[model samples]
Target: MGVQGLASFLDKHQNIYREVRFGRSRLLVDGCNLNYLLYFSSGLDQNHGGEYAAYVTLVESFIAALRSCDITPYVVLDGGSDVTDKKLETAAKRREDRIRKAHEAAASGRTMCILPRMAELVFIQTLARLQVPVAQCFAEADQEIAALASEWRCPVLSNDSDFFVFDLPGGFLPISHFHWREVRQSGSRSSVSCRRYYTSSFCSFFGLRRQLLPAFAALAGNDYVKLRGIDWTRFVQAGTGTEACGRLEGLLCWLKGLQESRGPLEVLEEALGLLGDLSGDKRELLQNLRLGMEEYQLGRSALSRFFLHGAPPEFPALEQEAGLVPGWMLLPVTQARLSGNVLDVLRLLRMNLGFGIETQELPSANQTSRPLRQVMYGLLLGKDRSSPVVEFDRAGLGPISVPVEPTFTRTSQRLRLDSLPQVALSDRLNVLLEALGVTQESLRLLPPQLQLPAAVSCYWLQTAQPPPDLQRALLLGMSNTPRSTAAFQNKSGIQKVDVDVSHAFSQWQACLKDAAQLNQLLGLPLPEPDVSRLYQGTLVHQLVHRMRSGGKLKTVLRSDRPSEELYRSLLSVVRRIRTRRTRQTRQKAATRRQQNPPEPSADLQRLFLQDEETESEARAAVAMQEELRLQEELLQVRTRYRTKERSNRSKNPDLARKEECRGRDLL
Candidate 1:
């Protein structure tokens, strides 16, 4: 998503980045990047689910390290993808690549660098616990991060190459070089050692105007605009980091040649001229080129007021800004209280990337949670809307867009998206409970945090393909069940990620995430679980293995009475919900059969001639199975929707294939 080969090119020049003993100032951190760096850098489990507690400890240590050096950190996170569809092509390619890598990682036993589902939630919660100032922006936080850093006269800490192009007064510090864990003390002062890059140094090295960075970035091909068919390698000077850095070096050299004589606008025009004849597409290309460059233009940070006054940043204006997002949701969306999937639903585009350890052959784990997301979609877009949400989900080794109609229950139909906040708490709770098919009374016996998870598990059991066995349900309940802090202090040794087990847990987590979002949208009718307490990869997988080896729950829990009680209480609630659902399904089936009875066939007459009680029991069982199958089909989104090709149809498939080949050759 940055200028191609820029990070490596800069890394080769030691003079461009000066070593600094960093401390005693405000540092703006890219929170999403930090989350990825922290989790993957620590080599925690990525296969099963996540080792969130250990990840929390790592975050706490990081914050403590910053405080020790008197360094103040203000973290910002990205909310959702850009609604303009500017980066849709890049996103689709990345999604396809991720799904392929995930399958490979699942088959082979390598770490795939996939951050678990709840890692973000755990990170945000940990920051709150440590009293670190943090904000999640409505969209990409790159510009906001750069803006805040410039205003504060402090370095932006991140590994993103886009930061290299942003004109920051303070500087840019790549997280790869920032040694927060290695704080050094020299008598009176404590400081962390790191490398810092000032835009001044970069501009000086390249002999170009600092303002030309945006133009330079666009010409080199970023996520926003990839100028096809123009090869700049022929224009580069021989042996000036050209072979190693690819086309970026060539582009920089060309920019340097025109720096003195031409302005940014002229350079853009001349660069577009290199593409030769575009016929009718020239204007569109020029507009896209300008749009790409506009990304690096900076202004006063909108987040300044957010950090200073506890106010959410105002929604930034978009190209398509009419009713794309409801005004009421802007605040919660900015606060990071609501999930980004909300925006995805509203925009009719759901970008779902596959997990690293999921079994590709199995039905996507996301399918199990379709019902939950459907309710959420209904709440966002009115109940009566017929438009389907186009979901870019991983299928086979590629990404496919499935058009899924949002399920609007009688409960969901009662409330409208705009007036949801004005609704009574009881009515909201009823909507949430009915959607999950549970009662408040049923959830009362479990811990507050476990209630939503328990309900999700019940829903999963009822709808999951090849319905989960009792043991699987019990393990899921245990995973959601909270344990003592001491129990999580030591991590179990790394073990191979079983694709089936990993996929199962992935589905459970998906359901929990959607349910949590639904609750948040419904004014938090149910208590939101502490994400860290919900699941731990190593512990849960180990427990499953122990149970499979004929170990009892008490033995696996080390005879911890309170933990066992919590596990049993959660399991009981889930079982009760499942039982009630089955009863309702059977009753509905009986009513339907009575309303439209089939003529008695020979087989039915033969069955009726046998024992009356046995025939009735067999007939009831068959009807229940048929009814359940039909109900599951109704709940599952994929079954109801038709899949479409990748949305970026403008790019020829053959040309894209050639580009992939060319990319490898350039590398």
Candidate 2:
């Protein structure tokens, strides 16, 4: 977690950072931070679920830039939330903020830097494909990243404000200043020119001791320690637009007065004492402040041997704790094959922060994927499914955490978590199919990669509230297929996102993502998805428009026989599933109606007996419900045909005049 306003404060002082031609060095990349920076900065479509194909291209280009400069990069990612709950409040607060921002974005149609759920998967998979060295830490990767960077004596490239506080020997290269695209060449060698930050320079410029950086971070209110009631801005001699930045300056100025001879503990005590009227207990505040400072204290990198010798990092501390993570899963967890959400579900009986945007009057996109996650929880918790997993999700304009029961079908109920890996591949595959409610025979016709997407589409059609129709589903399927990567390249400008359509696809992607993870947990019973091939939102939405106007599917496939075949197979599977489900649903309803004949309610009977008008009103109400259902379906299409017509009329004065005369004649 970064210190609030620290990055901005350092950015103001140009002397704190030195211009350098960065090359021919080992770079320890903060994978999580870099993922956010790369996606948000690239101007990719965020509102329309995601533009994964474009995102994949961007990631490849970034890696290519580093390779061209001969920079050996080691990427580190955060695994799960800290089990200790030190940053629990901070994480929750940020989640709440994101939820609010997401609502605002949904309402205003403005981008809120919401990284699409599939973006992380795409990033990690792309790196794996490119043969980059990557590691996922057990907890927040900040300390681990700092530790590894310190040990390797390499610069950490990230835009996280937390990096400014760490005293990295090789220094910090902020992504904001990292002009990686502008590679400078001098005869035989090339380098990425950028600004580098050294903590020593920051401390010296502020006239404070290098040893006191941690103390400064603690006083300035990091995520771990936000000392309330103290008005730090009051001490500011000068102010900036951001109050937090001014407080940071004030804190540094105060630290400058402290004696260099004083130890860290002494300096911390002095800073805590500055909280004249402490909001909480003084002792507790002191403890938190100490913990905050301790976050920056690095040890010998735990990942060095893992990076050098390819041995997975051991978590003996976690292993000793009974029923934390199974010993078998430690390797996959480190390799980033399994989602860290599994750890959270197991450790705390709660899954934190399933991020997505919510639409008004529409069920949460997550609601559609709840059953899929429930099965995932079953695979994770196994025998321990008595207690439900509390899932944090966006509800309306606020964040809500609700307990979700783990679902164990007949097939998955027998699989034990500890021995899951030892189970036969067929049995594992059975569990995946059972969870998705599809048979192996159903998926056999499609490509292995398309199998999961097709299965997920079937589930989406069956379960999604206000379900997507055949044409939309076909468009989504085409967009997700690998062939579509080349068929529908990234377009130039942002297209207006259809919220209803976007939400439906978001639900589908969420289901696909969770199912893929469960499949990974079950040793990849289905082929691993190339996420880059799946769901380019911009292309998918464009295809939807084309399909709306009666465009031929062959044009999108570009007459590529293999692509056309894949599309047809995917469509056939979906159509068969939808048809079977509809028949089954109707049969079930017929059976239920036959078993329990509906009786008119006493009120309805009395109303019918009392007046004919009341009977007509009841009939009208029934008709209204049908009308509303039709309207909901119509709204999902969100066709812009009328808007386009109006635009054309506005552009051509003759067309507008002709339309006006035609309207008068019709009247």
Candidate 1 residues 1-667, lDDT tens each?
Answer: 6877788878777788899999988999999999999999997878778888778989999999999999999999987778788988898888877787777777786777877877888998788667788888877889999988888888899999999999888999999999999999988889999999988898898777887888998888789988888888766787665236457767877888884768788888899899888887888888898999999988989999888986677676565756667677766776676766677666645645345466568777777877777777777778555477777776666678887777777667878887777777788888888888888877665555567877877877777776655445344435433444245324435457767777777877777777877888887777666778767777777666656668564543554654544554455456556666777886897698788786778448746667975666677577556545544333232222212123332346864464344212211
lDDT of each: 0.75, 0.77
Across 414-475, the per-residue lDDT of candidate 2 in tens digits comes to 88888776788788889888888888977665555568887888888888888686445453
- The candidate that wins on lDDT is 2
All candidates' TM-scores? 0.86, 0.85
Once model 1 is optimally superposed onto the true structure by TM-score, how far is the C-alpha of residue 6 displaced, in angstroms?
1.0
List candidate 2 segments past 4 Å from native.
233-245, 277-280, 316-320, 470-495, 549-554, 557-559, 586-667
Candidate 1: worst-modelled 10 consecutive residues by lDDT: 637-646
